[model samples]
Target: MDGTLTINGPKHTDGLTVERQEKPFHPIEHVDARLISLLDMAADSICLIDDHSRILLFNKASETLFGYSAEDVIGQRVDILMPQKYAEHHDGWIARYLETGEHSIIGIGREVQGQHKDGTTFPFDLSVGVAETENGKQFIGVMRDLRARKEDEQRLRSLQTELNQMTRINAMDEMGATVAHELNQPLTAIILYLQAVERKVSKLADRGPITSEDVEQLSDLCGRAIQEAQRSSSLLQRIRSIIEKKEPERTTCDLVEIIRKAHKLSLVGFSATDVFIDLSAPDDLPPVSVDPVQIEQIFLNLLRNAFQAMREVEQKAIKISLKIVTDEEDRRDRLQVRFQDTGSGIPDSHRKNLFKAFDSERRNGMGLGLAIARSIAQNHGGSLDLAPFDEAQPGACFLLTLPIASSPSDESEPKTESSESMDGSQ
Candidate 1:
């Protein structure tokens, strides 16, 4: 009788009828009405639940945030206000905390989605604490809606993307004269090839009979003409695609293929025949974790920088090497791309703030390329840096590191949590 809960009416427990003349204490009734009045007036959503996760007290803000009245959820399970994905986790953590006297989320603020009575979910920041009550322990949760903050972040991301596109356009503008000159070379070559083809045809007409040798020569000249035209057309198309503005889309891509494209595109103004580029990478390297177009922009920027640096040098050469590296601090695998140019090395004065924005030494240069590239790299859990100068090596060396994409086999289906919520009698 001493260990049992006292009830005024007869009640059955363990198949035995127990009668008592004592009145059962109501937690909300026993607590000071003034505390309840303060809770009702609080701005943030506040909810109190028992060990079984049943809602004991729900304030005005809680009712408004969850689209439910106090009477509707008073004796209901707390899961009613939680999204399906997080409801089970809420109960599990509570059970574990009570049994093991350990906490996974108690007194710690966490971002979680809350489900409204209309079945819509929204993000909220939750902070939970345990309070000692007359009956036992009750958990109090304070939640703040995050919709406005989330909207602000989304808008910021959009603005950043627009800025990146504009920077790329400005970089192209700086190379306007060079790109035009390069385009003229390919077009002029095509014309010369076509003229040679026409001359061969005229010679064949003058000759009495068309021999196998004559046919072969004409075929070879025509093929060369077609090749020259295709080269000009391809280069134009590549440039056009680069300047075209499009919404950013991300996809996994091969680093070697992107490097090759960027290298070809970057050599537009530079004498391709005079400048030598050597690229080497492992055949079995994993795919790069990056947005193909954004990563291509980075490659283009580094290549163009190297090409410009070697303008005065007699032998313009760039050595690009790629290899896998394991970060010692985190044990994460990354791909490192090295661009070592045989040109006048970076001056010591400009080395410290190399990636800083608007600090260009080159005439008419935007100085944003490296800064943007480094920002993009870091955003993808990677890095971009100028290799420390070595007395033995004369030219500047830029090292870019990127994460390796996870393989298809590494992905697993997401585990869904229970979607149950109970509304029991008060």
Candidate 2:
């Protein structure tokens, strides 16, 4: 609220003298006694000054804050309460405001240093306001001490640093094991293919002439071996990027391609032959603004979660669909990505803490996946949620919504992407 207080009552003759003077002193007449009482009883410091910046009135709280009695401060220049450097600029600051009617701090409050009579400076929050009086214009300042609040903020920062350190250590432990598990699949496949080549070579040495059939088989084995090697290399590179701690680099990219890559990565150690994963999206969808690596990490978490859920079931299936949610009035439409898994739906007991870190009953992980995924989504001005599971269908559905990137032209390539399906063969 502004400094000027309006109280309806008859004025009192008893008022302080701090106006036009033989020596910068003039009498303030017709001041209300109730107004004087209110200022004296205020919890925060209050000081009023005239056009010359000379103190017209000093409340009791101001006396306590500055270690100066009302008698010692009234009629003194307001600059005396601040440091010498600030005091030098005080006259000019007020002159500019009075001349141009432009405000620096008059209408806005800010933190500033206030010097006590003992020659020590302390931080205080100050807000100034101006009012027109019958005699002239007066400026009122309200200030609050900031020492206790500053100390509390410092303590909170320390605690947060400690908590972050511990979380990183714990996450590293879990992530290391996951990397080994995923790498084992491609590495093992590569080894098996190489061993088969060795056997084929040994057999060829015994046989005299090599047939075209023999060359085709060897070529096929080598190609498969190369594919497995490439898989291992790609997995390592992506995981390495994820492990490095750095500021997120946000950019616009194709969301569908990111989802496709993450789906391929998530199946690294899972039984892909027995499982059916359908990823359906529109051919022409606008790009989304996101930190590509972080967004990929989110999709990986969600896909792996679905994979883990269907591990024990004979009929396993995962369906992921992406679409645009058009709400023109909102001025920004969002991309909706939904993942559904056909397995034993989440138990009633585990639903409450599903997204909480280190709290999952069915996962081999420490349960940081969904929690981290949600955090990343929110940081990108998006959201991830577990939609209600249909008991009849017996599956869990996760919905992630992200904002589409803003383009120069309103024209979009086309369409939302859902209700359509791609076979697991891809």
Candidate 3:
């Protein structure tokens, strides 16, 4: 008879075996024992199965992998190593495979989840191979755990979320500092003007008929107070909207008025430090459409930076000038304002990236002032540029140029003043 396997005194197509009557050749038993030892000592977990999905052979590595002894696994159904959830459907999978001869995992490698003897499920990468023998077919499977990699990925994702939150908080904090310092001056001015008007009106006798001149003066002061207060309220709203992630509310605005408001705020810091301002502008200027609140923010940032630059100087002064120039070639018009500081000029090396985000040169400063200023300028269809400072007189000049409204008829002309033209500084 041909060589074959026999179990319980019955022939089976499991493996090749010599007839009982014939002498064993080529030390077959020794070879089999060495092969089993090699599989037991393998670094990777190994499992051997027959074509019927039965556990024909399992090494020490496989026993440790599935938390089962070799004796408990051998000759058992493969579903014993699977979790209860998977075991319920494993029999049907085997039956379908046997009938169709289709292979999903055979000769392929993929990722899967596996169960441990302690009722824990973990991720694993698996590779399967098929082996054909003289009497029967078998399969070898290798598996590796992925718990460590999965844990590391989760940690990285959490850190990214935390970093994003911190960035937003820092942005809001910076914006708050700017608004507080810039808006305080104009607010104080408005209050002083209102007080002055009240003092003048109180001088009249009780039930006295107030003159037209008195009423006109009082109305003018009240209107100014209302305008300044409205400006402050609008600025606060803009800052709040930014913190809340809402789009900035933009509308047609007078560019000259926005600059005047910014200058008013900066005057506070200058006065506190005993700095003087020399402001000049054309008699009449055209208005540029933009977000008034954002333009004010731009001016506030620039003025603050300029003031901080000259803080150590004995004579601190700021010069502001506005003009309207039309582009002959392109037929485009622009409103330009120049803010110059009589302070220490920027170093050549630092000037290259002065407006860049996080450009830190001033001591104990956040270095985001110029960056925010430039962003605001750009958002208003305008730009901020650093001009060459005079070497003899140390100072820096920032030029703000905004696009003029295309339809000049849409709005009234902007009011302007010369160096000596503005209302007295109270």
Candidate 4:
């Protein structure tokens, strides 16, 4: 029985069979109908390809898969099933294997691209097996459609994303109390300082010459008061930037200066820690079109989150890195910022909804910070994503991406304007 080919008989130990069906065995022509009867009822798409990757046999399943009747494809080249992009390389693969006896897909099951009757490409998982015979070498491929499985997986991911967003919104609400209190302290201080300064200035102006020293000190105090007012205003701006449902207004701005200011602003509450902000961009990394203030808020939120995650750890450090990246898919430039921390890592359970608004893992925190942070990132035509904090140790890293301007050196440098002295005409 060795080397004897069979259509439906059990495979022998030495690769032989009892009955061979080398040629088409039609029940009407042949004495036996067993082989033809077996062919009519298979559930999977079955096809036979020769050494040159030309279709030799097509079954009922093959017709249903490619929207073609068996008669239309039985003698055609197998490259018709592959998409245009894959067809070129596929011919080379077939020829190479025919000569070298090397097989990448034989006896293997894999996910591959398939072109339908309408020329639409879809995913399919195909399992292929090879058999040798007196007529020629043939490959039998059993294909399973994967569109349904892909859809189900996509639905699950969408639901998970929604749940995470809900959790983050809740976290933000919890943090509201802390944010409000922090903002109020500065506002209240600015009010008291302004009132005191105004009263002192009015009394001194009404009395004597208000000596040069007195006037100079008063001007210094006024500048300090203005700075305090600006601080309070900046806090409100940051909060409103997240909670307000509005799109970012893009403007050309210096990224290096923006990062420096944001880093300085974020350090207000973080004490007892050493942090570093590092920025590198192509000198040609042009002033990107972005909502500068909103970008600042995003950086602040990420920096604050990193600082909080690392605050309790012994290392007590966080780093901010900014760079320009190219998007191969979109064919555009992107402004990328990475906030890396050396702190206690996030628990496995919390990773899925980490960017969700108000989804805070900490009991005392309202999860809104990261959620709002992500919202702002998206509003600016970008995304915020989290990754493993470090390769060697433990921690988490957050990535912020924004669309960059077309080029860096496009603007004409403006002439510096002089400050004019104002007369108190009013």
The model with the greatest lDDT is 1
Candidate 2 lDDT, 193-296, residue by residue in tens: 99999999999999978899999999999999999899889877876666666666889989887987777666655555666777787655678999898788
Would you list the rank order by lDDT, best first?
1, 2, 3, 4
Q: List TM-scores for all candidates, in order.
A: 0.76, 0.57, 0.43, 0.51
User: What is the lDDT for 389 in model 3?
Assistant: 62
The parts of candidate 1 lying over 4 Å away from their true place are 1-27, 30-43, 206-208, 247-252, 271-283, 310-319, 327-330, 340-366, 386-397, 406-426
Query: What is candidate 3's lDDT per residue for 209-290, written digit by digit as tens?
Result: 8899888898999989998999888766655543443334677677667766766654543443466666787665566777
Name the candidate that leads on TM-score.
1
Candidate 2 RMSD computed on C-alpha atoms after optimal superposition onto the true structure: 10.2
Question: Model 3, stretches more than 4 Å misplaced?
Answer: 1-245, 267-273, 327-331, 362-366, 406-417, 420-426
What is candidate 4's lDDT per residue for 17-120, written digit by digit as tens? Answer: 33433343222223236654566578777777875566877777778788888677766778788797777566555555655588888878899899888888
lDDT of 1 at 338: 89
What range of 10 consecutive residues in model 3 has the weakest lDDT sum? 20-29
- Of candidates 3 and 2, the better by lDDT: 2
TM-score of 4: 0.51
Candidate structures ordered by TM-score, highest first: 1, 2, 4, 3
Cα distance off (Å), candidate 2, residue 281:
2.8
